[model samples]
Target: MQEQANLNRRNFIRISALTGGGLVLGFNYFLTSCSTSQDGGQVIELNAFVKIDTKGRVTIMSPNPEVGQGVKTSLPMLVAEELDVDWKEIKIEQAGLDTVNYKRQVAGGSGSVRESWESFRKVGATARQMLISAAAAAWGVPAAECATENGHVVYKGKKKTYGELVEQAAKLPVPENVAVKPATAFRIIGQRTRNVDNHAIVTGQYKYGIDTKREGMLYATIIRPPAFGMTLESLDDAEAKRSPGVQQVLRFDNKIAVLGRSTWEVMQAAKKVKPQWKEDGTLESTADYTEKLHGILAKKPEDKPRRQDGNIGQAFAKAAKVIELAFDAPFLAHNTMEPMNFFAHVTADGAELYGPIQTPERARGRIAELLKLPEEKISVMMTRMGGGFGRRLMTDFVEEAAMVSRLAGNVPVNVIWSREDDMTGGFYRPMCSYRYKAALNGNNELVAWHHHSAGVSGGGASPDSFPAGAVPNFQVDAHTYKSPVTTAPWRGPTHNYIAFSEQSFLDEIARQAGKDPVALRLELLEQARANPVGKVNYEPDRFAAVIKKAAEIGGWGKSKGENIFQGFAAHFSFASYVAQVAEVEKQADGKLKLKKIYCVVDCGTVVNPSGAETQVEGSIIDGIGHAMYAELTLTNGRPDQSNFHNYRMIRMREAPAVEIHFIQSSVAPTGLGEPCLPPAGAALANAVFAASGVRLLDQPFIKSGLFA
Candidate 1:
């Protein structure tokens, strides 16, 4: 009943109006339909952020968090590109929950630009049509003769900026078929533009999730069980209550929440408030976990088959030469710059939640589940994310805020997770291991390939993705192990591991067969492109293009003298293809120093060059961290490394000088968030082998002596 009611209300609010200059265009977000009359302003959805006021001012409501991924600028660029409005007149606002129109507001997987591109343009095209019709009516000319430029509509010798005709446009009929500019005619896209939020970032006025402040809002800190699956047994809060500014210490069924005047007070009180826990089971060491994973893989196939090819056992037996290698990636934490935080005001009628989150709609449902309230009564306000990576997707922090508010007798509560708590308590990227093998015939031709992967079990659900290559036989399998710690997508998810093993193994094959790695890949790509196999997931030509481009840019066939070494790798994800080459030099002490990195990508159309470059550079920096130093270790179910000091990220001095080049194409824009991450691992590892003759099969390359 509640769901139905909520759905009904959503439908009722789905169509609204935006009013300006006698215009009456319906002003729902992209999904909502708006109509305009010949004379005045149109009503629009309350959640609609991008609306043209009668004054012809462009207002953009950002639905996703902006943690430096340039969503604030790129997303609005899409809308403005179609709207034909003057960019200077645009005003930006962070959007509130009006799930009636927003879709895929969650920003992760580099899906922001790709997913929102079409919808944003639709919104702008609709608005532009309405403004043009109004101007045509006022000038007594055919609407087709009236063209819009710089917020103005001109027909013959007559001209009127949208602002001058908005009153008339408000009354003009909304055109049913709004015309969108073709790529050839694009004026706003494929152009380098500065980040829309740069001013806010420079001035330190950007409102991150942590910057949210409300009158009489009390701060909170949660104390979770130290060990996974543990139940709270007891609490000692007397000392915490005595701490300065500590207002209350509330104990719930599974945890304790400290409420206080300031974040520091909450943090100080949380430290003093000791909580006892009863272990749910015995702890397992990392080695034990590894053994367990192998055992699971060796056992029977339980779920549906992910992928299968010609009989693997028969193919292996027929081969004269077979090679096998194992690879592993340690658990990773998203470690978003801003710790988890949510401010919730729960009252009798409904609830209001404000903070940093990727998916406001998903957060609303999660809040409803935790608070046991109707979804309609809940409104989530998504603010700028300080850095999501993948950490902000989890709603544990939001749930904690609601729990604190519920316990506080309906008073509003702001739950703040200290950096330590967030690092230790949030979901982690699952650790994974891969066992790969390939069989070669007597003629030294590759015949079969197989990959068996195990770990926290996120990948094997779908066999590793590959193009229809020249290989005759292939098989992919997955093994799962139940983990105490919750897991979520970190960067590229499974592709991060698969790319390292597959690409590195391919390199090995090329070396053994006396063929150039790039040449071999190109040969297989030709087969795939000529007669593609069943259910292949990637484009053969695009994949080969990136490889070829990277090779040329890196001077692959050429060599430098003793000190410098080069390696290459390529990967496709988020509907895009990227290839990279790494140049490394060895220090006298046998330490590896990455000198220059070259990358080429074919991600369809470019949205914003500045935004695209930022994401690519950031992805490279992040990948370097994962390859060289980032890892979260567990000791008795508790994370051993809790802060940046212990679990290191790449510092400025360590970042290799990088060159990024894009393929000029007319394909639709694909995801740019994570495409560059996977190849960095293999490229760096391959470079390590070139520099020091070591093929590190595991991650945190430093631990494997790849760096030293």
Candidate 2:
């Protein structure tokens, strides 16, 4: 019933005239359809998303959180484009959590532009139509005679600004249906535009969640258990409380918190308090886990079949040659730059929380339940995030802050996690192992393929990955091992490891068949396009488009000045297709050096070309960094690496030169955040093989001894 009410409210728009003659147009989530103002009634909803002042300044609310993905700027560009207003005259405002007015306020899945493209444009076009109608009616002319251009209604030789017509426009009824501009008529979109918050970001004026400040706010640091599945047996905070600047030390369910007047004092005092914990002894060491994974793969366990087609046993029996290989990837941490921090002020009536959360609505509900308060009384505000990737999707940090505040006499408290705390935290990407087997006929034609993956619980391979529909007899099976460590989505999720294994295996298959890598993929794509097996999720033609474009632009087979070798790989994810080619060279000290990378993407209509390009570039660099050096090992069920010094990142000197190209099409836009990341690790591995005769079957290629 509540869902129906929200859906019904989305159909109508309300225009309220302010005392200064300003016009505020927004979605109406309450009140009846009548426009008449009643006695002392609040006709306008508080969730006004758009406002046009008498000075001709337009303000558009950004409904989603800005986690350095450029949604704050790109979303408003969509509104300004259809509103027929100059981008310079518009201001962007970050919106608070209001599910009734704004729908799906999220930043993950890269769906910001793809999902909100049509609805935001409709809102802008409707406002423009109402203003034009008012101008035409005042001039005693038909509405069709007046058209909006740049912020004015022009008919014949006379023109009036939108400010002049807003007063009368607010009194007019909204049109049911308004015409939106076509793709060809787009002027502000598809153009390179700077970020709206770039100046504030570079000037150190942008306020991130970690930079949030409030009156009488206290700082807190948590001392968590050393290992997974551990229980706090005893905590000694007598010395911690007596330390300088320390106010109090509180014990929670699984951790102890030290609250103080300053962050440094809390951090310093937190280390002095010693906590003893008892482990459940359910977690295995890293070496034991690796051996257990191999054992699981060797045994014929009960198969959880994801996809199966044709007779795989018969095809393998008739094969002339067969190839089998196994691959593994370690657990990974998000390690966001800002760490995890949230401010909470819980009162007797309600609770207020502020932080850089990816899902504000979900957080609000969870906090409300935790505080034992009504959902309507709780509020969650989103702040700019230093980085989210996929860490902010979890609300554990938010819940901790609220719990701390509630336990501390409902005083405002801000909980902050240090770099070490975040690194040793739970919710890392699950470790995975993949085993693959392939058979070929006498004519060197692929006949059958089998894939089986084993991983920690909640991690599995994509059944619809490449070679699924391309092979005659294909099957994918999965097995899971239960453990106490928590795991969640990290960027591309399962596709990240799946692409590395599948693409690299394809390159090896091409070499064994005495065929070019790119040619072999194209042939398989052609086969899938000609006679696709059961429901193929990807468009074969679009998949082949990026492959051909990348090869053409990258000069696939061309020489790259001596010692430089190139490699190519492609994959499709998040409804977008991307292909990448990497170039590498061997250094004198027996080390591999990345030179350059060429990429081709087909994500449908480009909203902001500049921002899209940055996403692709960043993904490539991030993928390379993880493939080269990022890995989290375990000892006694605890993370071995803590800070950046041990879990190194790729520096600027090690970053490769990147060149990107996008396919031109009129289709709807898809996400760019994760689609370009899957193939980068495989592409770099393939390039290393070309430069030096080594086949890397595992990740963290630097430790695989390719250079040694």
Report the lDDT tens digits of candidate 2 across residue range 460-560: 67889877788889888887778777787888878877888899889988888888999999988887889777658888999999999999999999987
* Top lDDT hit: 2
lDDT of 1 by residue, 1-708 (tens): 011111111222222234333332223334444433223444344555456655666676667666667887888888888878767777776667776656667777777787776667766776787678877777778887788887878888788777677665545444554556799877778889888778878999877778777888899888888766678888889999999998889987588999988999988889998788898886655666667776766665566556676666788899988988877778888888888999999987679988888767788898798778999999888777787777777777887888788888888888988888888888888888777788888877777777777777355333646532456677777766887777887877777667777888888877777778788788777866786545667888888899999999999979776888888888878899999999999888878888888999999999898889988978887887788888888777778888998988888888998899999988779988888888887888888887777878887887865564
What lDDT, from 0 to 1, does candidate 2 have?
0.83
| Alpha-carbon shift of residue 616 in model 2 (angstroms) | 0.8
lDDT of each: 0.76, 0.83
Question: Candidate 2: where is the Cα deviation over 4 Å?
Answer: 1-10, 13-20, 27-48
Per-candidate TM equals 0.94, 0.95
